[model samples]
Target chain A: MHEAAARNGITARFGLDFPSFALDVDLVLPARGVTAIFGPSGSGKTTVLRCVAGLERATTGFLAYDGQVWQDEARRVFVPTHRRPIGVVFQEASLFQHLSVMGNLKYGMTRAGLSPEQAGLDAIVALLGIEHLLARGTKTLSGGERQRIAIARALLRRPRLLLMDEPLAALDLKRKSEILPYLERLHDELDIPILYVSHAPEEVARLADHLVLMDGGKVIAQGPLSETMGRLDLASRFADDVSVVLPVTIGAHDDDDLTRLDFASGAIVVGRRPEPVGRKLRCRIRARDVSLSLGNHADMSIVNILPATVTALGETPVPGHILVETALSGGERLVARITKRSSTQLGIRPGVPVYAQVKAVALFGE
Target chain B: MLTGDDVQAILLTLRLAATTVALLLLIGTPIAWWLARTKSRLKGPVGALVALPLVLPPTVIGFYMLVAMGPWGPIGKLSSALGLGTLPFTFTGIVIASVVYSMPFVVQPIQNAFEAMGNRPLEVAATLGANPVSAFFTVALPLARPGFVTATILGFAHTVGEFGVVLMVGGNIPGKTRLISVQIYDHVEAMEYANAHWLAGGMLVFSFLVLLALYSRRKDRVDA
Candidate 1:
């Protein structure tokens, strides 16, 4: 183990051989904020989270969280799941059927040798907006309500790390929207680092500060969310979902029923937003929605035209289309997907200035 | 109106049933838990052994138990070594035979309940800082309450209704080993039809009420 690296972040190396599949991964994740493990289905994302939670014992594995060794196969030292300070919310809201809502929340607190007041049970219940549900049975709660209770129960354990495995996958769209705000609040308020396993790109773009991309039981790419999402070489892997997440501030609401959002590079105006001015938000710009021209066209209807320089070009899965990687004057990156014919006609190359017209921008409220 | 002999028999029967149910519950819980959760190859053979008394005649179990507790049998030798002499024709002897005869009644329902719970609750409990032992007591036990209730009633009722095993092992001793079922059998043998009718009708009503309670509760659980 590298002492300096282990002290600052989580270090994990795991290898397992199953009859149908094999998993081998080496990861160093930051010790704070949400880090999403994103991949397609059957890509071993959940398995990675399970291994971290000490639920699945990898045949050959070593894991250390912020300098505390949890598993080391060579030393024959392994801490069992219950002994590790972790809170896990499984895909299904696995609340105890025999326990009431409040009973379920207190189950972990009692085991941790803390009373309800000491564990701050009331605050957690209020955070999840489940105070009215304390007296109800688990069977009668809706899917979203049950999930809220499950999250609250996990939190009451006072875990040092939290692992969520697609906690919203089982809920309908309406239920998902209802629960997403609570998750955002957790990401904002909680000091514990969260390891979230998700295959949904929207969830990753909206919530993750750091990203780990996986495929076929392996880690393909990992870094800060914006840096990794803008890599041209990995653009084909994202396929139609290639987009960049940019942190922007609500600048002002204009008189023409529009709101302006300002990032490092420049400002973009969109339909009126309900948030107050100066509030921070995240916006996603898809590669397919961007078009580049050699000279600015003032007569065009597009309002988000910004001058950028092409940095690199990479091949996409589509035969004729190519991915264009560019940098704004302020050092923020953007990607645009265009045809091979347009690339040759405009003689687009690295360091060539071009005007990028962003056709749409999707904003995610914080 | 019942005779003094009949009253004594009823008391002895209740005592035997209560003792057998208590012993079965203690011994059956771990076996049922293992059967419900184990993936070992011994599961098949062990399950078959527990269920053997359900299909085999009580006389067979009684015959083997009688031989085992006799003067020269292995159990008899051990008891003699421990200063217990022999166990046949004693209240203790009948209680052991009743436990063996009603083994399946206590184990199967509890095993079914544990199996129906799946592995989710235990996993949840473990993540909540409960060790395996703590989870069993806090989560698994409460979740399987219905199974315990069914097992208790079935074990007690089966022990009270057993005649062949008790008669074969206990030899119909008057107050010491004579139970309600054995007493009713002796009455019929003596051509005392009136006494037989009194004891037999009571047994019939008791059995009906037990089954009624079990099924009605099952219906309520289904409705819930």
Candidate 2:
């Protein structure tokens, strides 16, 4: 497993100390797809991203990207941020106020020794949907437009890795929604690994394939998104926002204003989605929306019920509540938060058979 | 109408101001950049030293400069060792003194501009593959342009209007050190009120126009 990871992964070990806070993290993240560094505010998510970009020098650090050491404090090998093949998008749009949109896009390209055509500047502009905004001055742009341009500028540098520090945090909800599609496009079309720092769980569920949960400058958990998010022990850290992300495909659209989503387990139905059949989507199922029953009730109003066995149970921060981990027949996992009394009443224990009724699913596009 | 002597003084003053502004900018940029970004304990002492010219009388600076450039002084000794002779009472002497006298005018504005820019642009530039020197020229320098404008204008205007420093360091060479302010003093002492009026009034109008242009441009930037 270690050999496989070393062949195609980023191995980062950083220890940084500040007066009020300290960051110590050792992460081995996959080289492809988006990996989210997630936690509540002040969990040192941004610090980890900064260390990877060489923006913050860790006191004791070892960082290697795909077997090439970018920083090794022991060997006295350190590549400065400019020398590293990485692009960064700060929280704010941070566009150069002195340059036009086109100028900003070309700013990194010229420095990277790549011509406009060579950097695929036109394709990137079209990818971010900023072609019409090329000649506009940065000051005249809206929040969403500026962020789009910033992303395009980062891409124009032809980076091997992209570090995004809450790129959507500074924008209002309206602007965030406006820019999310472009971000989704980048994830689909680009092959670069993205280290995204976000405190927003919804954004993580919608975008991330792997999850690294951090708290108080330490890694609490890290794994594939579904397995990590479904962990019973880490449920309380999510507080009232406990949920799991499932990779599902559009199986079919029923005539009765509903659509079926197929996962590794049996399919579940949601309200009719506009996406075509066979298109993949990520759906976040909040643990609070799931309920457990001792027997499958065919007469219930809930239509998406599947046979599951209780895997584990853990206490939540909420009074008298327990988070129950269950594995469906086909091995997909789900977490259902239930009252302690209800768990006892339903005989919900490890190895107990039960049915999981999913009350809601929030679909995120592929 | 201006006399030939008056024209010579005016030309000399312009030349001194131009030379002083150029020298101050070259020397002040690094100082201002350091003041803006450094966390060293020496920042306080260094900043106070730079601003000393703004508070102290110009004659105090001129007196020290005069002594330092005298034949017996250290700078004079170095100059002689280099076979360049003494510097006092020469155009070069007055130009050096003017640079010291106007140092604050050039450095403070640029420092303020760099501080206001924060570290975001430079960090962004670095992540975009610009080295430190490249970042400064491409990012820091261009963003601090308004400060440069302010510094150039203030440095030029302050150097042109200087009196005590020029009088102490350069004495009154005919076509070299006798600037407009000294010429105006000369006219008044000689009871040539008409001549003083022509030059001094010109100085007044010119200073006002320069300030007006600067402030209006600043207002435009603020509004934008």
Candidate 3:
């Protein structure tokens, strides 16, 4: 229901200036879908999520989202965390350790004013695949499973927005991979906008529809995945960064036991099973795994080759790994880790054309 | 047949213990919660006051109570003014003294439980959309069930065994304020070992069972 017309505008003004840091920068995020704020540790990423959820108020300014005005200091209005229509998943899982999983889920649902029917307990159970876990005590669950339950519990409240602070940060690599698909599902399926904070580049590439790149508590760059990622000069500043995302479609599978991915820029070869037709796939090429060749290669075991233009060449903070920012014809930017010796031997320079011999293409789950 | 005194004493003891527990629950809970959660500068003095009965000579509390509730004391004058007559040496006076003397027994367990439970659960409940008061009932009190059990049993048991305070304040007045402890002491002084033995033995069994229930219930909560 549309609240009184006065309640209709939801613009979250997240600008916080700390003594030696700025926790957040200004932005008006879209009202729907997942908006992942990606940054490294100590970069004030979680502070942004905290400010939006009203767990910690921004030092100054207002939170406006949807048509509802959640916070405005000028109007002397600030909703406390309890009154705010926000659900947060802390990195620690934050499950009610004393209560059974079902009890924990009901703890929020019972207080949300909506009945069980409105929140759809059964539907959320199926959504997160937590039906088997519902009756178990929350403490007994594994890290990955606990995060899934946490997400489910937050979603069950039917929140206006979900703020997750690196919810999978504590999980192991295997657990992280398993939770990724479920998170991807939530991103695509849920109606509420999610402000997910993570420093994981691959995660940002796969799950985020909009990326707010933060560094030192400032919004350094932000836009749709492809548009902002092209600022190869901007992304080059992050030290020892790996993997550059390439948005490509499954062209077809190869007989030599590999999946052929056709990017608008160039085709890539990866070892993955058959995927359904026409679905977009994010092929992750680790910067270190990709080596540059001045000319086309003939004897290499590497299966995929692409003609990439040298966009920016700079020495990485960590020596030996030269940061190569290259662009595909489709305008998708890819960061590669090539050795300086190869840079000099190939006479590599900015604006020079080269072949990106991708050693492996890790296809993200659809 | 046995004399009427023993039966009357038993009835009086139960009435005293029950009333004492009710009164303690009313006053002790808020104080326990405060001791558990407060960061105020008043904590040290309040804590020392609550635990005074555990170490202070019972006769000291009794002596002060007697002086404070005498006909000329403030409370005694006020009650007499309201037409209640003298309060000390009465059943109501014994109940009041028992509550004061057994406060530590009721408050310690509740305070420990609240401290161990911490503020996280309450904060989580707040973020879940429940107000503070509702969160206390739904989250905090339920989790502190073992503390409540311990407080109730200890307070009741301690009140049942009260002697010095009742002797000083209630003055061994039968059918009005005489409790089991005073009755047992009277039987022994009169060399009626049979009456004293039965009364003392009954109290021993009652106290043992109360402790067994407390320990076992605490174990169950720990396991849960």
Candidate 4:
């Protein structure tokens, strides 16, 4: 029964020593959602991803996914990369130069021994919006298009886990936005859990359900995205990226071309409505964009104001800044960064009621 | 002007060159692959040994081969023990000498090609579920086609042009070890100038055409 109780998702533990760096980490990741391993360059983010994919052999490792042991260094049971049922997307869209897009996709499907009916290459192409590129040469694709093809190729393998190493790091701003929707569709439709390695907080914020914060070749923090980002102790680390990810349902479009997004507490207005009413969305409001007031200020220039109670307060790395955690009317959480001088002047503390004037809300999809 | 002896020598030369090229390819691919991928300290020494024949005089190799393949030598002793006679002054003697004389010609091009391939394509193949052996044959070999062409031409041409090594090892046995280059030498020694001109002219044109074809095919592949 104890061994049967261990039947869960992926658990990866790795200890790798290089001449210039060493990485040691142990993590238990969810089996169904995207888990982001976020860190700066050389923070061992990609190294961890490679280890899970069996690409890099760690000195000491124990990796198991859904009760199957992929690696156990002590036992000398190491599954080679080719034998592991996983797919990887590198920073560069490393397509086979000799193969067209269709050829590349078919290569994965064939190698994985998945038939067209099983892998559904046609459905995947439709999902990634790569139907037009099937016959085209890989060399002819733009950076974003190539990356989309790469993602589709990886997905067509029907991998148990997908390891993506900074898939959008090589794209420009315009190209990133161009490929984001396809990624969102993948995160929505595919059952394959993804281990996404990235240095960009925005990418992590947009895509991740679970967050693993890495530093100095080790994991410093890991938890649900909303809770991890709102933690007072971790606020200083994510100082510039302190934002609440509020899941809201689209209510109605106002006459002034504003979309009404309703959460547990209240509705917030954003720029022109995107998806139709009733579609769920996530809105990210940065702490700095939020200003606190004792009561409602109707004459303020800010468009959105919601009542909240002070839950906690913490210091930021910047000397004059203080980050405030507040519970909205329906127990939803929000954070605001104000000056320490104002914190004392306003007598802001836990259990005190306040009004938060939000400057902008960046709406992302479910 | 071409006599029956001339025809025999030409046929023998073609046969020797073909056999040498085939053997070199079979033995050189793995050696070149190892040299390209190895990080061992012995790589430099082994590479120098393979390239030794490139810079050394053909007669020097021929002298060594003659001494090494004679009845009293180690290889000759082993061959006789195996029930085969000594290798010197025979067709196999010239063939063996030509393989040694053209080792670098077959190895260097393939080695350079493998090195230029880097590690990405093979890594990609591995991620696509190909083992190392399959990756080498499917991805690495196909991508290194131009190198194979260059190696084949160089190995064949160098074997056909072998004279001093063939003479030293085979003792100029007519229709047995007398290759095109050795036959030309004999014609010159016997004052048969016109026959020498025909064989020599044919070889010159043939080498040029082989090189031309290799370059064109390489360029076409690059363009494609």
Candidate 5:
């Protein structure tokens, strides 16, 4: 499996210079699944996507995806954007205003010489919930609706890769929630690799499988999303939102306004979730929400008390705080931020047994 | 009460205007698109050359065209060498002169339209598997309909009303080089006030209608 994955991965190296900006990136992105380029504005995230899409040619670059060479500045070999098999979802949708939704969708299909059945137009329309909007003019649609049609249009081309550059940045909160489930459905069902660019932590946490964290036109860290998010050393870069991601399966729905989720080590109870039993979900455990105790306190209001062993401890950015990395019995890792005074009082050190009282678990739909 | 000469001149003017606009659409589109999208150092110089006619006096343009189309001029020598003979006083000579004189009228509006359409739509089209040529036809041209309409109207009207350039390059031959503007000059020179008034009144109404149509269409586009 490892050999097969390495053989099929995408390798990209780009270097560009402008009067006010410079971008330099070298990435070996997964050829399948969603890999997010997470960064702040002006950090060159979108520029990287544009380079991959061939919309903006890098001054010096090389890109080879799954044995196909898309660009090589050294060889003077560059495929024009139109000939590249890729679909792009811009931030504003960028639908052709003169065309109806159906016309816009057909634009790609005709250009690719693919019939409706071959392009899976019916399935895509149903998947994106845009069947009712076939004949509607694009200018008349709302922001969320326009984005859905844009996504459907891109998919109709049956591109080998899909690039989404901050696709949700233009929408309001309600619109964002309305569109996110469709995006998740696309991610689950589609076979094409997706390079999603965004600066929103919540959006990245909810959807990304692999993470590429960037700052000031440089990549700070990159790895699997769960492992990267759990690093205590990088906690300061994310401000106070550092946390660990737990892959959980829905265990049971109780009558006491709670649902049980089974993780590696133990079961966690959270507020009621509508997902059915046995459904897989991701839960985020914020470090600040956990409290360390030397022994299980029966008088505490927190219901979660799982046995854990101190694995490592590091100083936090705050003057009087410390970050603790602990391993549960099942070898699952959890991080907690505690006051330095509390750590001294509890005599917390590596190999010492403790109980972690988890105050919250943020459940995400599968 | 139109005479045969008046009718001939009117038909000739219509044909000339139609031909001039058709040629402008063909020749000016690429120039306009290039001006809109190029950042090269030559853009300023080329743009100034295209706009030179807008500020120059038509009589001066007429004088230069007259000299260039003369029997010994370079264009005349080339055409003569090709067995096409000299261009002066011919219908084709007036057509060539009109094309140069009315160039900016046709190019500027189309250039503005292309500039107003930012790079997003074309980029989207490219990612959807359209080459640059196909993207221009499929996306750029459809969005630039208003600009084309303006160019056609302006190019046609400016060619119709031109007097100095036509008189200089085309030596007022009836049924051949005798355009409506030249015919009006004939009526006035002969002191035929009644004929002059008839042709002049017709031109007045036609120019007003063309401008009225342009402005009303522009308003509709804005509201849409």
Candidate 6:
């Protein structure tokens, strides 16, 4: 019945109030690249992922990706999970407990009408760094290793898109770090699109080319990571910004223990970007930690900036400053707020400009 | 010292247990898998049919098998056409009846194991590239090892203890299917208490040991 969605975008008619679980997500983002869906607990991130995978039915909606339409009430198109060209990596890394690490990956590839020879077993093994784990039993694997194998196994199906529901959520810090590179590499190396669900803003910032923010089953904000989280009114709308993630290309490493993170227009001076040369990193900025700046301060080296295009300008109930946004030419985006008095003195308006200097540590931690 | 009849019954019972267990395994595995996975409307009826012998009298199963395998039934017709003659009152007939009567013992554990495994592993297999059938083979079967063992042993032990079914289907044909259970009953009825005691005691020990072995091994596997 998902044939309708196979034709175009998924349109959920359920609106923002889901009667059953009270979750309402409405977004028809391009089904290519990584569209990360983030939310707090009970925010329905997994449910949305499940919906796209066709695991669970949406009360009312139409989902379409690429050229394939998955669900549509108007057309009555619905595709069963097996018939869908999608792969899912569950939060539990549900490896076939009966099979070896190698066998688990091979299981789905074998069914996808691709023989071991055709699927290139070694490529996946190498990509997930599971060569040594091939013969090992699934029961013996560490949480991170299991998830890597789970991802590898899902990939072998040659699916058009991948669905990962916090695949790294079960891992410890060390394992999460260890597996992050592979995930990053996977996004770059594969041609297929991915829809990742996570509560970790760090993952969204670093991995998502597009972000769909969810709260209480609704799409609160969506678009590129910086643009979406860069909304000034976002913090006041919610108690505090859950996470503010930004993607930046490395510019250079400064001698003063700060790395030059080249954004869209200006460079940010974060302590370090943990990647090799030319690697992209998702650095986080917490709203609670950020403050407004009118211009570059000579005495301070606290290095992030907002060239301050006023994406939004208004009085906040907190009786502080007006929130502002500035889009950089580099395609990178930032957010800042100056006091209402500062806005008046600096003559900031919807299109007026200013600077948003960031503190050394903002909402950037895991 | 026991007579030649006692020894003959012992050998016959062993042969029956071994044959029944092997046949049950071959026949029960596929049936259990089907019962475990299929959601057909007939599943309830078919499952009950498989379990019928466990609760019903053994003589009923033996009588049905005898009728189905007699010179008048299709199987009997086919056997005679092939020059195999009548099936009733033969070792083969006894074996078939035992397989039917002990079916639930073999199938239930296997079905439970399959049910417990759930669809997760199979789905995982499908996503990995295995088609449905291969996934069942590669992922489902291996995990049900302990259940298979339990079914086989229980079926074999139950078959060894059968008296009524063997009597109805195969009769007390010496050196053929005059099983130990019938022999023990015969001795007791004839007031041959000592001989009955010997055979009954042996059977009790054998069954206890089989159960002990099955459970101990199962516990170890599970614990491991």
Model 5 lDDT per residue over B74-124, tens place: 888888889888887888988988999999999999999999998899999
Residues B19-97, model 2: lDDT tens digits:
9999999999999999999999999999999999988988899999989998898878887889988988889989888
Question: Residue B3: error of model 5 in Å?
Answer: 2.7
DockQ of 2: 0.88
Which is superior by TM-score, 1 or 6? 1
Interface RMSD of 3: 1.9
**Which candidate would rank higher by lDDT, 3 or 4?**
4
- Pairs clashing within candidate 2: none
Query: How do the residues A168-259 of candidate 4 rate in per-residue lDDT, one tens digit apiece?
Result: 99999999999988888888988888899998878888898999999888999999888887777887667688888888999998899988
- Quantify how close model 4 is to the true structure by its C-alpha RMSD in Å: 2.6
Q: Per-residue error at A227 for model 1, in Å?
A: 2.7
Query: What's the lDDT for candidate 4?
Result: 0.88
TM-score (chain B only), all candidates: 0.98, 0.98, 0.95, 0.96, 0.97, 0.93
Model 4 residue B196 lDDT? 96
lDDT of 6 by residue, A280-358 (tens): 6666765545565556676876656555555555344455655555554554555554567766777766665556677
lDDT tens digits, residues A134-238, model 3? 779976788888888888878778887888889888998999988898887887678788888988876776777677888888888877664454345554544
The lDDT of each candidate is 0.91, 0.92, 0.79, 0.88, 0.89, 0.76
iRMSD (Å), candidate 1: 0.7
Which ranges of candidate 3 are over 4 A from the true structure? A1-28, A37-48, A57-61, A73-76, A92-101, A133-146, A169-178, A198-206, A210-241, A315-317, B1-3, B67-86
TM-score, structure 4 vs. true? 0.92
DockQ of each: 0.79, 0.88, 0.46, 0.60, 0.86, 0.37
Q: What are the per-residue Cα lDDT tens digits for candidate 5 across A208-326?
A: 88889877777788888877777877777665666788889999999998999998899989888989999999888878888799988899888888899999997667778888999
lDDT comparison, 2 vs 5, better candidate: 2
List candidate 4 segments past 4 Å from native. Answer: A1-6, A235-239, A314-320, A344-351, B1-4, B72-74, B215-224
Worst 10 residues of 1 chain B by lDDT: B71-80
Task: Say which candidate scores most in TM-score.
Answer: 2
Clashing pairs in 5: none
Cα deviation at B113, candidate 2, in Å, is: 0.9
